[model samples]
Target: MFKVPPRPSTSRIPYAPLPNQGNDSGATPKASSPARSHRSSSGSCFETPVAAPSSSRRLSYAVNSGIKPSRPSSVSKGRSSIVAPAYSNLSSAKKPGEDPRPLKDKAYQADCIQNIYAFLESRGFDKPFDAGMLQLPSSKLFLKIFEFVMKQIDPRFKYGNKPEDDILDFVKGLHYPYNLSRSSLQQAGTPHTWPPLLAMLNWLVQTINFSDATSGPGTTAAQPAHLTPRRFEAGPLTNLTSETSPLDEEGCRAVFFEFMKESYNVFMNTEDETISDAKSQEMMQLFTTYFEEARQEVALDVENLKTELSRKEATLERMQDKSELKKLQEDKEILEKLLSDLIKETQRGEKDLQGYEEVLLDKQQELKKCAEITAGIQEDNALLCKRIQEQRFSKDDIEHMEEKLARRKAVLQMLKENRMHAGKEASKVEIQKVKIMEEIGQAAKKFNQRAAR
Candidate 1:
């Protein structure tokens, strides 16, 4: 009959790892997170916020001038909806009783202006005014003023034809003479401050013109009513607040221009102060963040250290267990070897016992045969004695009687020899049986010893 081979047992198959499988102890790592994926993706790149330098300056001027910049008609709705936090809110809130010192001081203002003049002079600008060069027409102050304005507009601007004529022509375009008061210029006493004052006026004109050009037409309509520049001419210095006396013939305009320059300097100085304040605040916040991060990092380090200690403890325990298991395995192997030796000795003892039993059986058979022979010899001796007692008195009978007596005596002698040989054989068999029994007791003692072990 054709028989199919039996299939191999499933228990014999080696184990294999499955795909995307978790461990039996539930220690598998989790999948990647969405946030991590997004950060790692090739398409993600950060953009720096565009901070317009001109915009902040313009915004400051607009706040003071009542003239606001026009918003774009096509501005994003999302952008328009997002309201920036007020500048006041950007600083930390102050206590009600904390009185702040004034942002500007007259002494500080004068000192700052002096510093500016000193810095300019130090850079080799003409200080002929201080050198007693008081005659305005005799100096190159006008040309210097014109060149300064041109450089402020464009560093590469050159005087193509008559430099003076070109400068005058540019001034005419800005309605210069129209804005200046004739009497004020003639009354400016010492012509020393003329060139700088004119330069200041021209700089202001340029600033206003640039603002107008950038802000577009609708900017004028967006002007706020309350915020207006404080005028120092016939408006405030003389008419409104006559608390101080005039310094010169063009006292109003001179004070006004001086105020403009002072205000501009104050603004610039305050800006630097504001930057310093911001930097200090940033450093404070950075220190705060650094401490917080340091604390968290220290905590993490402590936790990691604890985990490492625990892991090392577990590893130590595992090593100890391995050592114990190895000792147990060695002991088990030694016991197995001892058991195998005992079993072999038992087999050998059983074989020796079988051989002794066979010898005892042979000895018992010999003893039985000797017993039968002795019984037969005793019966024949009794029969022979009875025949001798009944013997006749004839001569032939006497001769037969002598031969019978000799035969009886020989039979007795042979019987005695057989009896003695049987006794010796029985004694030898008893000794061998005792020896065999002693050997069996020894074998049993050995077997018991093996069992106890």
Candidate 2:
């Protein structure tokens, strides 16, 4: 038996199998079946499993095939989106003799030509002939007309009195009816010269027309006869219109040049206005951006000021804390001095108490000796009383004995009271010594801790 490849797990997307080529009839597979049974070319039966492609792979395939994905069934009915048809059809016809531009471009060109012809007619270029018969004059006749037109247009232009001298210097210095060589015409840089030529003529036409229309009847009459408008013989112009004679096309091109020159001003003015509007808009946008940047900078400066203020406040607090610490140190020093003084006083008091104790002990010893003497004297007195009872004595002797006994009794009583007073003074001195020692101990402990810190 042939082993089939194991299917991928649930997370992985499987590659879809192509439909059978042997079966000409197209029928979709059933979803209810797990696998479809197929017969191989060798007539062996095998099962082929169908697996759905992943959404990501399907989207990638659609993108590669230049197809857009459809919305979900909830948004739109459960159907795949249809593709839009591309516009590929183009016209094939060609005119026999014409510029190969679109119909819209040709129409625009025609309108421009008509406007030029209208402007020429209105300016009396075809004064001698009817308005419909506008045409070019011969070179000789053209020179006369050119001189006359220039004299009317510019009051400063000087002309020759003699006929022979009229054509003199005509060919010199950027003169009109400019030379057109094949090489000059073929150069890429030559076309730029035409617009300036047209602009100059356009300015001239406007100046001339404005002077004429605004001129009073008295001013018109004062003008020279040659400058005055006049009709011309139609001989050269008639010849230009006929196809029989073969005059150079340049003469005819000159007529169109004059016509176009008059019409150029309108379009130039419109373009200038558009350009100025665009420039103004750009300036406004730049100003707005600068204002926003200025506002942002101001906000940043405010934040910096706030931070600086906070720092200053913190520094002030630290300084205050340092001053407080200095005060505490001063107080500690004062307390240490007081404790040292107390300890010195305690030492002196201990010394004084020791001297007092010695004095008190000496007094106690004296009192004991005095008490022994007093007891012996009392025994002698008792013996004297017995002797008086045995043998009668003088009254003077008895009186003297009584006086001596009273004196000894008074001395003994004073010694006993002095001993008691000394004992109380010694106990008080000891209590004061203990208190001073405790104070000194506490002060020393505090001083050591401060030194360690």
Q: Against the true structure, whose lDDT is highest?
A: 1
In model 2, the runs with Cα more than 4 Å from the true position are: 1-321, 390-453
Error of 2 at 269 (Å): 99
Which segments of candidate 1 are over 4 A away from where they belong? 1-119, 126-139, 168-453
lDDT of 1 by residue, 1-453 (tens): 101112222222111111123433312222211110011143221111111121222123221122121332111122321111211111111111211211133332233234334333443455364422322324255455345444433345455444444443333222231223333343332344344333333333334333322221212332331211222323112122234333323433333333333322233233465553443333334333433554686688899999999999998888689778899799999999999999999999999999999999999999999999999999999999999988858998789999999999999999999999999999999999999999999999999999999
**Each prediction's TM-score against the native?**
0.18, 0.16
Clash list (residue pairs), candidate 1? none
| Cα lDDT computed for each candidate against the true fold | 0.40, 0.39
Writing each residue's lDDT as its tens digit, candidate 2 over 45-158 gives 222222222232211222113322232222112323211011000000111122122223333323323433444555445445332221322334433344444544333344
